[model samples]
Target: MRVLLVAYGSRGDVEPMVGFAVQLRALGAEVQMCAPPDFAELLEGVGIPLAPIGQPVRPVVKGVVTGTAPMPAEGLPQRAAALVATTYDAVAAVAEGFDAVVATGLLPAAAGARSVAEKLGILYSFVAYFPTYLPSPHHPPFERPGRPFPPEVTDNRALWELDFETMNVLFGTGLNTHRASIGLPPVDDFRGYVLTGRPWLATDPALSPWPEPADIDVVQTGAWFRPDERPLPADLVAFLEGGPVPVYVGFGSIPVRDSADVARAAIEAVRAHGRRVIVSGGWADLDLIDDQGDCLAVGEVNHHVLFRRVAAVVHHGGAGTTTTAARAGAPQVVVPQMADQPYWAGRVADLGIGAAHDGPTPTFESLVAALETALAPETAARAAALSGMVRTDGATAAAKLLFDAVLTAEPQQ
Candidate 1:
């Protein structure tokens, strides 16, 4: 079978699809990816053919993180329309002869991919990295700018209804316009059309379970993760061997505000607990607080391996980072910035695996307090216990499911 995996957004969004693609190839299926060009190096290293889609994501994300970008409500319709058109063109250009197109990431892009699959009469599936993207009475939908729910409307069902309406309002025109141009029927309900009834939830059930008795019949595939086999840098290895295990701090792809301040607070907090600090200079570009020997700044390394050696993982609780830490049995201090981060943070706290900082910005005192909980012996024990339960074969499972679906649908000779 030939498959096209489409993902658009940040590294967290694209990395899981890479894992799924790798697994599909291992299962003897041909796989290609359509994602932002920011991950070209990552894809090249893994040897997956990439069809670059949309603009580079880093500058856009950096703009949002640093308050230089337009607000979410500013010209959203234009942006949404352009994104849909871009995605459609990118996917349609290379979609011929493919058996399936599995899409995840931003909704607008997914909608475009689905439309192309429809036009080509091929199979299409939408997968979400978190449960919040799926409509469920268990939780309320995320409030969008210029579309806040009424004060009196607290019911989850009602809020979800509002969510659908918002989706239509934001994306319907663009989707239908493109559909018309492509000789396809208009999509009346954008959300329903994009997230079909059986959208796959690619999250670890042990860490982020879909609540029972919910609205949609979600296909809960465990988190799609690719094991990182890159050995730690020589300097990092020396740092680990040089001292007692240090707290590992990094915000992954998030462009954290006041990075120097955050780095200082993290270093001080780790020092307060008598531990060293290994700071990852992700998109935030975090660095050592004061050229101190106790703290080290690094670029991308193997989180799967580094997390295991850390005293604790302090980060901006992205789903990928949180899951990596959980799998490594490393306690966490989750400082949520936006989107699904707070959800992951809450999970960490609820599971007794770590501490959830109250908000995004971490003061010296707050970091110290959160680290106190993360470094606790009980937290470490719980983290270790949970590590044994995290499924590492999510990509393989999802790949087999997709392959089987294709095989079953093929007309018998």
Candidate 2:
């Protein structure tokens, strides 16, 4: 069988799909990817064939983080239309002869790929990394740019109704335009069409559970990730062995303004607790505070190895990072920036594995307080206990499911 995995957005969005692709290949299926060009290097490293789609995401992300881009209301509709066209063109060009197309990432891109799958009469599945993306009475929908739920609305069901309408307003036109061009019908319920009735939820049930008595029949697959096999760098090894384990801080692909100030605050907070610091210079470009041996700034290292050696993980509360830290038995302090991050932060605190900082920009005091809680012996004990419960076979599980679905759909000779 041949599979085309389509994902677009930042590393957080693309990496999980790559993990699933690896598992599919392991099952003797040919796999390819359609994603942003920014991740070409990462895909190449893993040996997955890449059919690059959309623009390089780094500059766009930096612009948004630095407040240099147009507001969502000003440019979103145009950009959404263009992305739909681009994604459809890219996927349609290379999706032929593939048995299935699995899509996860930005809704527009997913919609485009799903449309292609519809035209070809092949299997298409949409997988969400968090439960909030799926409609349920348990939680409200994620706020879209330029669209916020009315203050008077307190019920979850009502909020979801509004969310579906908002999705139509923002993306329905562009999506329908492309669908019509491809001889497909217009999608009235745009969000429902993309998510499908039986969408897959690829999250650890222990970390992010699907609330019961919900609307949809969700297939809750455990979180999908390839186990990191890279050895730690020699210099990082030296840092880990240099002293008591240090607090590990990183924002991954989420950019922040004034990263230097953020770095200084984090260092001060960690030092106040009498611990060393390891800073990851992600897209934020965070650097070490000074010529101090107690602190180290690194780029792109194995979290699987590093998290196990950390005193605590302080990060932007991305789903992938949260799961990594949880799996490594490291306590966490989640400082959420935007879009489902706050949800992950809440899950960390609720699980008793970490502390959830109140907001995105962490002050010296906030970091100190959160770190104090995260560094507690009780928190570490809980984190270690939770590590054993996190499943390591989510990607393999998803791959087998996809394989069976394809085989069952094939016409018998």
Could you report the Cα RMSD, in angstroms, for every candidate shown?
2.0, 2.0
Clashes of 1: 0
Q: Give residue 322's lDDT in candidate 2 (0 to 100).
A: 96
Candidate 2 lDDT, 1-413, residue by residue in tens: 99999998889998888889889999999999999999999999999989999779888888887788745675777788888989999999999999998989889999999888888888999999999999999999987888878999999999999999998989988899888887888989988888988888999988888999999989888999976799999999998998998999999998988889999999999999999999999988899889988999899999988999998999998889999999999999999988889999999999999999998898999999999899999999999999999998899999999998888994111
Off by over 4 Å in 1: 410-413
Q: Candidate 2's error at 322, in angstroms?
A: 0.2
Task: Return the lDDT, model 1, position 263.
Answer: 88
Candidate 1, residues 143-195, lDDT tens digits: the string is 87677789999999999999999989888898888889989988788998888
Distance from true location, Cα of 277 in model 2, Å: 0.8
Evaluate model 1: give its TM-score. Answer: 0.97
For each candidate in turn, the TM-score is 0.97, 0.98
